[model samples]
Target chain A: MCESIPKTMKAIVFHGPHDVSTEIRETPKIEKADDVILKVKYSGLCGTDLHSYRGHIKGPVDQIIGHEFLGEIVAKGSDISDSEFKIGDDVLSTFTIQCGICWYCKHGYSGQCDKTNTFGKVGLPGGQAEYVRIPYAKSTLIKKPASQDHADDSVYVLMADIFITGYYGVKKIVDFLGQKPAVGVQQLEIKDATILQYMVLAPLGVGPVGLCALRVLNHLGFKKVVCVDNVPSRLEEAKRLGAYKTINFETEPTLLKEVIEKDTGNVGFDAVLEVVGASAALKTAYDSVRRNGFISSLGMGHEPLPFNGLDCYLKNINISFGRCHVWSLFPEALEIFETLKGDFASFIDHKVSLDESKEAFELFDQHKVSKVVFDLTL
Target chain B: MCESIPKTMKAIVFHGPHDVSTEIRETPKIEKADDVILKVKYSGLCGTDLHSYRGHIKGPVDQIIGHEFLGEIVAKGSDISDSEFKIGDDVLSTFTIQCGICWYCKHGYSGQCDKTNTFGKVGLPGGQAEYVRIPYAKSTLIKKPASQDHADDSVYVLMADIFITGYYGVKKIVDFLGQKPAVGVQQLEIKDATILQYMVLAPLGVGPVGLCALRVLNHLGFKKVVCVDNVPSRLEEAKRLGAYKTINFETEPTLLKEVIEKDTGNVGFDAVLEVVGASAALKTAYDSVRRNGFISSLGMGHEPLPFNGLDCYLKNINISFGRCHVWSLFPEALEIFETLKGDFASFIDHKVSLDESKEAFELFDQHKVSKVVFDLTL
Candidate 1:
């Protein structure tokens, strides 16, 4: 446990697109009233990290790059007095932090908060360093289960972003409260009948969001997680994370019909999650869902969504696309990780030290790793 | 009353696409015990009737032509002794005569019944004749309210088609009973807290279905019904039917967004009904609806729906499409027309004699009339 601040820390900073290097910089300090300084233990590379590495994100250099992370609190702000979080508390941080008292936060939509903050961006130095600063610490940090070992925490690291995003997708359709009966074409009279039963999961551009959807479905008790991807490794990883089935569109272009028939006996899914931002993937997700089904998109593909409004209207389908409030659902995701211990970390197949940032980034860029975890013990 | 079987009757028979000639034909005899003979008092020309006239539908050149009609029952089968109707009761006939015990009929979806016997089609003689045979009379006929004058009954002709169609669209989204709160986006809970308020009504292609939605909303007590259309006449009809505002898409390509903002204060609609089967109109309905809103489409536009599955899954939208079951909701519509006679018939604007079928067909084809009532009384 550290009482005084350290002077220097080793970190990987993104200078520009495709230009990532190791540097010795001043250790991050606890600045905001609700901020906490965490001694970075583990940071995972995600697809967005790839996007940033490729210079797709509109931003400046010198942003400590990385969003998915598990760490230990090194220091707490003056206002933070959580009994559960001490200087040595092993915890994970949500990628986006919310104050949790705003209008969106009150509505459980902290992901869309007005004053929300994201990690590893220009404004926020993320967990790519030994010392990482976390804003809205009370709402963003979750303590690891005391019973599980550190290696077990890697699978649950997705609680920071991906898993919660998937759960939020499913929650929108079916009322989780488990009341009222399901509605069909025949029982149109049973008003207020929620038809959120079918789901579509488009892991279009594979990475964390796709895998996170698989992990979250398993954690949330969904037996069948339909995973769509062109890459075989990611599909294999999805399978291991308990995806009911994986359809490689590279082989089966008619995957939508297969998935539809498999679950709904030829109707269509009730919900679909498009993790890829490509226009084609978006269209496929919309077509695959049946009458009254819901679709959730987490990828930030910058192209204007080629929205077919009239078709969507006729199908009675609903669609919403944008960024997520990672801060709001972080707690529930943490609870899922804590409760479901063994399976969460299975997605992380490669582990490396902070000094090997170049090697880790290369493996990630080449799609050679499921999840490249940085062991900050160095 | 003595009943005598007739060998022939005056009938309007079709010779070709543009030609209809009056011919003397054998009067339709009751074949089934469930059939009733109606002495045709009035018949109406529908857009589909014109479609049939233009050689759009596959039928014999010499087949009978009209479907929409009002009549007085002159003969009943031996098995029909229901007190609901007698030998001289005036009634309106639904286009399709459905057997009540069939799978679709028993479930109250007689419109989709596999064995539906449609009038004026290849297998049946039509109501354009002086006397028409109706099968399953108890299920398909609605006795005209004794309070209204016979001339004013033309207004109720729509009950056979558009009125019931619109009511079905509204009933699909809102709870009409008032005992159950309308189940829609407003009632959806975000995560574990928060309730969304407000809804959207995106009506694509303001045809009969769209106008029907506007009328039903008035009956259902919705203050704001956002109407979308390209034709000025349809938009005008929409306004007359109580739409809060109408957006003509032909004038503004992004009319969907404008209608959504105008009606919902920019949040989007809670529920939308897509009446136009065009792919673009479907997309418009999709774009205008807010997160978790309901979109129900009743249009039969033929085209592969350009669907975005991921967006729908995440947003938790509900979509239902295809033909509406008129028989299931006809009773409700009949009640509206019976109780609100003067108010309901304001939408009917055209009346013509049987010999003027060509003129009526022309007006309907040219969009010169909303409804053309064929006075068979000639």
Candidate 2:
């Protein structure tokens, strides 16, 4: 395995805002006893990566800049047990490293773990390279099916972040509707018969996470999924993924709330999944939801969202916002990926070589691509 | 019963902002078939009453002005058939009239009933008189134990509004903590062991609702309950009830967040009950809650509470605001009152005849009294 690994590998390195370039960096080694070296096969660009590239998120200069990746274990430290991980084993890396023994990780809230550190962003080196080092390998690495080849791995790359995030938003909405995950129930049961059956759903921001949420909702049997976005391509994609209705905010003179209420028979949607971090989108979710409806916020907006206390009080809307507990949901998400079988790959609109990452970042920022995956082998 | 009923009764009526007056008005009779005329023995004034008196909440001119009352059913319509209630039976009225058959009512959310109307506010006539009609008596009235007398009924009178409102606030916090009331569990159990034990609590605005919340928290065995208020008397009352610490915001140089953190071992309060409708108090609650903590809002603020979405999102704080489902929790609250006998009466600081209601409103408005109860037969 060491003979196959190179001394240096090509990586897209960040040097402050809008200053990213392909550079040769020494391949990462096992600095900790629990660390494992992975030969990167695929890496996906996310909204947070764009933020880091734009310097909205501060991090070390010249850091390898990517968090979502699928790879094979090339080398492991002495402490890595063969039962947990082995060389040549296919695996996906989580965006954040979580100590599985922490209180948050133990309670299925690994996103908020005390020692959590996101790769390529702040605390750790990233995966936008030919080889990357993974710390806390036992907890951070999820084994992908050995039968799956590179041609079908893009969806698995998403399992690292956005897919689980989108699923988390839907889970929050279901939980908000009082349908907790039962021990023996095969499907989520609606606890309240009067709860409007959650027939209609609107996913604001038809970005990668939003599209994933739409697809998941479609798989979950939501009857009328309304997709909202200003981008025409995203709307088209949403429709192809079974969105019952699509609303383009830029072209429509009527407010989103008005259009949604009209489309939903003037009662408003049963629930809205807000993936756009903008307060305007949140406000649309708030206004478009029916009484006792929920707005599951999975966005990361910097601005304060103006909430009318009286309005929220009277409507009794439930808004839940947080980062995705990706590690906790990895097993179920993998099962879902296997079940969906190539359905999620349609979201990968562009797969560019590692050298094209700088341009990919610009294109993604310009909304030219729905999802951009980095082909490390290219 | 008809011969003993009077043609007129003296009641406090809302004419406009600060224009409430005691006037002799025609006594209300059972208009609806399910309506019952209650001869009000005791009526508790609430913060909402002050809002109506200040012209903040619109209502009919010269309408009776109290919603929290304990009374005897003096007259019943022909259709009254609920075996639990009858003429001459002692009862307490909920602030809002619930039909008990609407979808919301059937689903245990009577507070959101489509036909719901708060007494003395908006369309419904109120109970601040010798006689007032209560619609949907079977769903709206709770039978007072025959063993309890009128003098010991102040706590029961609170069941109509503030007590339940306070308990509802606490209930939201407990629910946010993931401790739903189990079938036979006497105490609310912390479902998640990793969830910080809810040791410290702060009830902002030590008014009737705040006092009731503090009392409920005491009964639930919470340690280190902090009461925040500018009123010295209310603080003393809170301490009398079992507040571990009291902060006089008006006199404190430090901000509420700072004070709370200092009092709570540099970690913010586990949960905060926001009872003041002011945005400032809501802001304090937002700032004082620890990570993954809850802020249960039970206040009615006309102005939009300025919420920092990013801050709340990053902290993973849960903010739930709504009116109390009083009818649904009446049984448990009554049992709690029975268990904590005579303990809640300290909240009734002053009692006066119906004629002195105008002065009582003024004194209460000036924050001179903790709770003012109107004695109809005084």
Candidate 3:
């Protein structure tokens, strides 16, 4: 493993806004007892990186800026045993390094762990490089199953964040719908579930996460979902991803009302899955849910609370909000990802090499490309 | 039943701010086919009625104002049947008259029913009046069980609002704790529950509702609960009602932090029952709760939402907010009320006749009395 490792690696580095460039940098090494160095094979450019790029979310410059990455584990620290994670094994990095022993993690809220650190920020260089060091490897890395080894980058890259996130939102929705995971089954699937018996569901924002939510619902054979988004192409993608119906929020504003009246008999959706981290989307969700309805939100917006306390109470709303506990939901999401591989294949619209980071970021930032991945193996 | 009724009755009527006068008003008769006249035997002066008295909540004056009342059903409409409900049976009034046929009612969100009306406003004269007319009587009135008939007005008056609201908050908290109702049990009890495994809990506001929460938690053998309030007398009442510990919010500002660190080991309470509707109380709840904590709020506040969306999202809070669906929770709440009769009997601090309305209302509004009720039988 050491002989194959390099002294320097070519990688994309972040400077100021829209200023990502390929530079030869010292390859990341195991810096901690729990650290593991992965030879990056593929890494996806995430929406959050755009926040850092646009300076919307302040962060240190000249750092690596990618979160969704998976590769061959080339090296590890002394504390990492072969049985836990070994050299030459394929693994995916978790978006955040969360201490699994914290109260939040123990209680199924790993995203809010007491000791948590996100990759691609501060000294934690991201996966957008030839070699990246991942601390807390036991909790941060997911080994590829022998059955899923052939899935490759386009499919498994999502195993890191968005896939788990979208599925986590769906899990919360399913929980809110009062349907528990069937006895003896660890995955989140409605047992003996029939579409006729299900409640009306509306998933706002047809981004990658929203698309995944629709797919998971579809896989579970749910047929009452209506997806909303302002982007037309994404709306089309939403429909393809098994959205029972799609509505463009920019045009046909009456579509939601029509759906609410016709589908729910004027009562709003039984639950609203909000993944768009914008106040407008939240307001729409608030207006579109029935009283005592559930809103499962995974949005990361910093806007002031959209709904007034009086309205929230009057509506009798039940809301489950937060970043998804990706580690906790990974297995279930991976199962769904494996099942929906064919449908999610189109998700990675661009696969550029490390040198094309500038063009890829520009296209993704402008929404010219639906999704982009850096193909380090190229 | 009609032969036993009278044309005129003595009642306490709300005329203006701080003015409730005893008046000889015409007795209410059944108007709707489903309506029933509950001969007011005893009625509790609720916090909401105080809102109506001060004109804080706009409503017509000269209307009787009391929602928590139970009495023998003296008369009924033509559609009445024995199996459903009948005259001569003792029944308790629900806080709101919700139509059981609506979608909201069918889906466990009865509080937001499309066709719903509250007593003590407009044509729906409240339970403070003798021979008060109740619409949608089947869903608005709860018949007292023969087993519970020995438990009279004071214990049962709470059955109408605070008792159910507080219990509802606990029910939400229990549900948020991921404990499901045991099979074959319709009530919300943690079957085979153990105090050693229960999460640290904090119930803010030692009012009647908060006190009920403490009592119910105690009934279920939950030990790690702390009750908070600014009122010293209510705090004492809370302890007697089964609060494991009490904190005077105005005095022991450090008490919460101490409990958080000492009791919860600084992780914060797993679940916070926020019964006080004020913004300050909500802020306190938000601050006191743990990351990924569950906040079950039944407070009816019109204050602007006190939480920012970003903060709420980051904390991963699960909030169940709204008026308790009193009619829906009647049987369960009644069961607990019977079980805790001795503890809840002291809830009513003042009981007087129709002529003492002025004193009762003034005392209750000024916090001179913890609770008050008009005993028409007196």
Candidate 4:
């Protein structure tokens, strides 16, 4: 796979707020016994990566900036074994890794593990680079479908972040209060459990997280996936993906409440997923859910939205805030994706060569793509 | 029992903001068949009564303000039958009366019944006078203990309002979602059930409501009752009543965090009682409890406290608000009070004659008394 031992590899790094540039950096090395080296074949730029680019949410400046990726394992540490994986195996590694023995991992909260390590920004070098080292390799990497060619990375790569995140985020609704996955069933034993038969996804920003939420809800037989967003393109995309209804925030300033009450008998929506990391979206998500309903906010906002304690007490709603643990859910999410193989590939809106990485980020910064893939072989 | 029928009995009227005076008016005639006349033997003043007196909370200017009381049933209307109650019987009536047929009553929330009526500030002539009319007599009046004399009105009257209010407040933790009380176990044969183990009672202002909460909790065997109040005097009362912990907002500004982390193990309290009608206290009760916890607020607040919808949604909390359904729980509460007997009198901090009623209001208004009892016969 190596053409030569180069001094550096092409990567997209944030120069400062609102600026991203392509630069050369030495290929990352596996530093620990549990580490594996992988050559990134496809990487998707996310809204959070854009936030990092804009310096909205704090992170390391000048750090490698993409997280969603599919790649091939090229090397392994001495302590690594091939029980389920081998060098040269095509796979998707989540942005995060958990040792499976942590307080968070043992409790099924691998996303919040005290010892969690992420790929992009604030951790070992990210997948934006040509070669990246993955720690706790077994916990992070999920083998791609055996029938697929290496060139088909776009179809399965999302199992790395977006797809699994949506699945994991909903799973968290049941997992947050329980000791294990089994215990989550116990949590639902709460009496007068208000039944949430309808769900609304707020501010459907043009990204995989929101779409994956819609896709998964559809797959689970939720007949109505109300989409709320001002942008016509995103709303259209949502409708195309089988959303039962779409509300343009421009036409309906109170779209969230209007849609929720209309569908859920003038009370509230059963569950609301805040995919857009905006204060207004967060507030809408909070206000539109029914009593004892669930809200999962996957996007981290720039500032802490002001909270009203009295209404919260009076309404008795539940709000969960955290990053997604794609690693913990890849197996199931990948199974779903592989079952519908080529259908998932349509999520890729653009493909760019490593040499065009800078322009790809610029387009992403300008809201030009939903999913952008970096083609290493180009 | 009939004294000369004065055109008016001695009445306390709220002329304007904080302007209260005792004046005599015609004793109100019972025009409805469901109504009964009670000779107010021992009427208690509550913080909500003070609210009406001070005009902090709005009520009719000429309204006679007393809701909590124990008295003698001197007269009954044609529709009254002594199935569970009778005339010449010493009894206590709740501030509210449920028709026992409305959706609310059928659902066990007798407080919010469609035909329910309230005495005192809520569009009814209160018991501050020598007699007051109680509608829906069968559901509103509870016969006093057979072994007790009329002199026990000081404590027995509290059971009609404050004590039962506190008792039913804990009913919010009854696992109602798991199984209805009237329903059999065979109906809920599902093996999986989430049981609640802890409850948090946040009494915003420590007056009668908070104290009654302590007395009721002490009777129900709930070992962890955390009383939250802004006043040191109220906290002292909470401590004396055997509260597991008292969160003093004046002392600890981060009272919510402390209460949740310490008492709730950082998840949240099982049931939160917003006894204090203050907006801030309502807010604390909401923020301190965990997901799936119960929030029950009694009476109205001066201003609407905006709620935190997201936080509540993530936690699966449920909010219920209304006046106490004193009759629904009076039988059990009377049993508890009977068991306490003379000991329940500790709640009576001040006992005054009918002539000293003005002074009683002043002490209750100044927060000097936990409960003020008016002895008319003296």
User: Which candidate leads in lDDT?
Assistant: 3
> Worst ten-residue run, lDDT, model 2 chain A?
A180-189
Better of 3 and 4 by lDDT: 3
> A67-119 in candidate 1: lDDT tens per residue?
88888888888777867478789987888877766545554556655567778
All candidates: TM-score: 0.70, 0.86, 0.94, 0.68
Backbone-clash count (model 2): 0
- How far out, in Å, is residue A212 in model 1? 5.3
Candidate lDDT (C-alpha), each: 0.67, 0.77, 0.79, 0.65
Candidate 2, A1-378: lDDT as tens digits = 478888889998989888888899998888888999999999988777777677777856878878999899999988888888889899988888987765456656678777899888656889888899999888899788766555567667788898888888876665565632111101213364433346455588888788888878778767578888888988888888888878888997475656555665565776888887788888888888876667888888777775778877887666777788788777766667676747777778889898887799889888778788898766
What's the lDDT for candidate 1? Answer: 0.67
Per-residue C-alpha lDDT of model 3 across residues B1-378, encoded as one tens digit per residue:
579789998777888777788789899888889989888888888887777678787755888777888888988988878887877898888878887766666555567778887787776788887778988887788777676356555568888888888888887776666633111101223332355446545477777888888888878767778888888998888777666778886898798888788877787777888887778888888888888778888887778777777888888878888888777677667777787877877677798887888888889899998888888777
Interface RMSD, all candidates in order, equals 7.9, 8.6, 9.2, 12.1
In candidate 3, list every pair of residues with a backbone clash: A309-B305
- State the lDDT at A243 in candidate 2: 87
Better of 1 and 3 by TM-score: 3
Candidate ranking under TM-score, highest first, comes to 3, 2, 1, 4
TM-score of chain A of each: 0.86, 0.91, 0.93, 0.86
- Candidate 1 displacement at residue B65 in angstroms: 5.6
lDDT of 3 at A217: 78
